[model samples]
Target: MGGRLPLFRDLLPRGLLGRSVLIILVPILLLQAVALQLFYGGHLDVISRRLAGGVAGDVAMLVELLQRETIEDRSWIFREASWRLDLALAFEAGARLNAVERRASMPLLPLEEDLNRALEERLRLPFDTDWQSDPRSVIIRVQTPDGVLHVEAPRKRLFTATLYLFVIWLVGSALLLSAVAVVFMKNQVRAIRRLAGAAEAFGLGRDIGTIKPEGAAEVRQAAQAFNRMQDRIRRFVGQRTDMLAGISHDLRTPLTRMRLALAMLPRSADTEEDLSALTADVEEMERMIAAYLAFARGEGTEQAAPADLVELVQEVAAKARRSGATVEVVAPSGLMLPLRADALRRCLGNLLDNARRHGRLIMVAVDTVSRGEPGDEAAPAWAQITVDDDGPGIPAAGREAAFRPFASGAPGGTGLGLAIARDIVRAHGGEIALEQSPLGGLRARLRLPV
Candidate 1:
């Protein structure tokens, strides 16, 4: 059962269009299949039986007429049966269905059964009916004292025209209707796609324009809710940014005055160290303020554009190498995604800086992978970016705590790297996780939908 779940999970579609069409189409197909089975099994069988029985009766009568009439006179009777009864008559000497100078016949089972039963009840003499003996006719042999009488009837007698027409109409109508449904379904899903795309872009903190809701009523309602939510989030971020901006402005002047006052103090060894300490504290306070303002203002002011992830990671690696950090990278070419390039770059920069500061050997890689079945293209694939390093990794207990604002992983650390990275990642509709890397240190894995 556990194994079966994965098989069905892989087979099912991952998108609205495919899923919706599948949902509508599967039952229709099944119903048609059931209908076909019922028609073929029940009604078609009855029709074929009646037709075959009629052909068999005509065949038996032709055999009887050929048996009674003389050879010369039989030609005229044959012509009469051929024209009136539609049975082509022939008489052959010494032809037997037995093994010596004969062959067994393979008949279409439905026709064969009906013809055999009808001929048995109607005919007094021994006879052989071979449904498959001729492609265009039903062949019957009647054993007589003089010779064997061969009777040929048109094969169309064994099949009803209405049956063929019904089946063809059923199949053709099913296909035509399915195609029309697909066209309408694609249009309906198009509107839903627009709604989903807008929501995803907004969640990623991009400056998203409004979406015109055009789907079913429920879908339109969802889109309206999404728009309202976006408005509220933007308003809240704007208010917070304004407040933080005012506070930072008010505190800077007093800090500068205090710094100048300390610098102008008389040169005394007793107070110099204390003044230096105060200066460092003020600088740290300013750094915290900047980090706070950055976080508060990150409600998505950037427009989205297509950016190559591989090149972005490579550029980060090159810059870190220039600063004397050993970084190894493995990435595929042409890995493009719609993103806020500057914000993503800053987010990755923070993670790399943090890793480089703690670990000696660092590695970065960008790859695309399926969330479940690897080969299924329809299953959603994620673009994954991994940064690994050789340093003591964070404990499982502190991993979640590390993403909290102002919660530093180490002593004397600002503790905003992972938090900011997480914020930026989540805004892009991605996820970041901390885990133990193969290099014996923390591994930062980031994933974005492609």
Candidate 2:
């Protein structure tokens, strides 16, 4: 039983539902137990007191008969009153008295050594209490011509019965309530779980269809709101992607014409400077336009197959090194992560390029893990991709703004690199953040959920 308790405990999440139910039920059970004790004790006290009062009356009657007979014949009265009451005759008057004397008390006659223990074990309460301290209890008194007898029975026996009954009722009730709560809560959680799974798929760029709301009204409202938001974002993205594609296509013809005209111009010393400036301006404009188009197209949301992340990083690093950039794969071993092939590579390539362009030396590392089961020790299921550099990192205040389009702080560069990288990463169900690196510069940490 003890072993199974831990097993049951592990099946539940550390959530509010379990805690709330426990908080509510525990006190109620305790209260019920206490109430049962008090109620049973009260009932027993009433019964005992009535019986004691009846015994007192009978004793009084016996005393009166003895007194009258003694007044009439003193010797005869002494002989008759000296005889012990017969069990058979006592039962004829009251069957309960016979049972009490015979079944409850008969064994304690001459066995003085075991008398107290026997009575307590058989007829006394299961637990002990001070009956003398309690006002409500049975008080038996008898008066004879020779002497007076007094006895008191504690009300603890009643309390014990009540306690036992309370436990029985409580256990039965709690079981039924818990079962019902499980069924109802399961139904509520099922819909929410389904919605969460769908949301995860959506986050990972999977085509999740509209979810039908379920459970309580509030949950349904939240599901509906999410659906509406998703639809709006998708529609806006589709419209913008088409618009950017058209703009890029249209701008290319005029750009081609301008380049041809510039090339056809007569050559001169001043013309060379003027043409270089013209070309630079055109190229910068073109690059800005391309970046805008990429942003508008929602490039990250594209569906791509899984690729070897380590290999991808290695290839990017190789390319950068060939371009005379100081980028190295510090810890690229065992980086087998499930990821969007093109998008993930693009993200890493952009980050390395950014580091080389802004920072001095660049270092990249990857680690993969699996999430653990409840009560079972295991690693978290995710892959962390870290890009570290020893460059003049962006200030804390402007770090957030650096991801926005055209928000660059470097000379001879557009500020679109980080933004594009983030979009691509997020589309693959990953997050990218910039923080102080161990390399004394900026650290780009990317976490991808498996």
Candidate 3:
């Protein structure tokens, strides 16, 4: 059943006008061919009878003239007068007689043999009535005062000229119609192809210049809709970025004043703890605000270029080592890939910081992954970067909520790290998730599409 499904489900639309033309033209051609058959068939019937009647009339009249001429003068019998009359009459009637006979006996016409037989029987009228059933020839009998005279003329095929004419008409019409359909289909497909390319460019975040509203009305409407959507997205993103930048600028001034004021506190024994606590609170507040600002103004937002994945991981690991954290880099391939460099750095930095804060050791593993099974669905080629730690892993149920802003599993933690990391990754068109690691701690996985 599965093997047969493709044969049954030929579900992709062939095209609009192509299918429509076929629906229209096929039946039209069939009907025309049928009408041609019927019309020619009638012509054959009429022509055959007319030709046979004309011939019979000529023979009767000629015979009557010959008898009278012979009676008038004895020399007329030996003078070949009948032959001369026949030659003269035949020259005049040749075209009409041949046309009728050919139409009557045309094999291409419907039931030609039966039609010929009927014509022969009808033309046997006052000429000579004795017609043979298995006739290859026309047998004529004339009653005379002396005895009876017998004349025989072979039968000939009818309707050849009509068949040749009809064949030319049918073939010529089909060729003309097919040529028209081919030209029309080609033009339509070209327009559709242009629209498809424009759509793909838009999806890839490239600026598509004004789309020409060509083709059918539906296609034009779709292009117009796409243009509107792109305009809206650009406006919204611009406004949001401006707002975030303004807020960050306004906030730093107060935090700077607070830091200056905290420095003026006395270092006395009785009140040292309270002063230290207050200073610590100020620093934490400043850190949280800075994190918020960083999240707001995402890295590489203004620029993106290709970078080497394995080298970037190694650089991050080196930075963590300098900061007194145990981090290792593992990569299967040294892949140079296109990415927003600063955004990727910020995402990886946040993960490394989180692991250092909560775990004994950090493992940064990088590899290429095929995200699904091979056959039924396409296995997407993706870069899989996993940051794992050796500590108490995040609980299964609570892992999903950890990426939300202000969601903290640890005490004295602001919970903005994972949230900011996920945001940065998403902005770069990648996905990040938390799962249990083999190291008995949280595994942060980032999958980036190529």
Question: What tens-digit string does per-residue lDDT give for candidate 3 at 79-135?
Answer: 443354232221111112111113332234443454335435544433233334325
Clashing residue pairs in candidate 3 are 101-158, 102-158, 102-159, 103-158, 103-159, 105-158
* CA deviation > 4 Å runs, candidate 1: 1-19, 26-38, 93-109, 124-126, 129-135, 264-266, 304-341, 352-393, 409-412, 436-450
User: How close is every model to the real structure, measured as TM-score?
Assistant: 0.79, 0.65, 0.59
Ranking by lDDT: 1, 3, 2
Tens-digit per-residue lDDT, 122-165, candidate 2: 33222122223335543333333343323343333222354457
lDDT of every predicted structure (CA atoms)? 0.80, 0.65, 0.67
Q: lDDT for model 3, on a 0 to 1 scale?
A: 0.67
lDDT of 1 at 94: 68
Candidate that beats the other on TM-score, 2 or 3, i.e. the better one:
2
The Cα RMSD in angstroms, rounded to one decimal, for candidate 1 relative to the true structure is 4.5
Pairs in steric clash, model 1: 204-427
RMSD of each: 4.5, 10.5, 10.1
Q: Which candidate is the best by lDDT?
A: 1
Predicted structure 1, TM vs. truth: 0.79
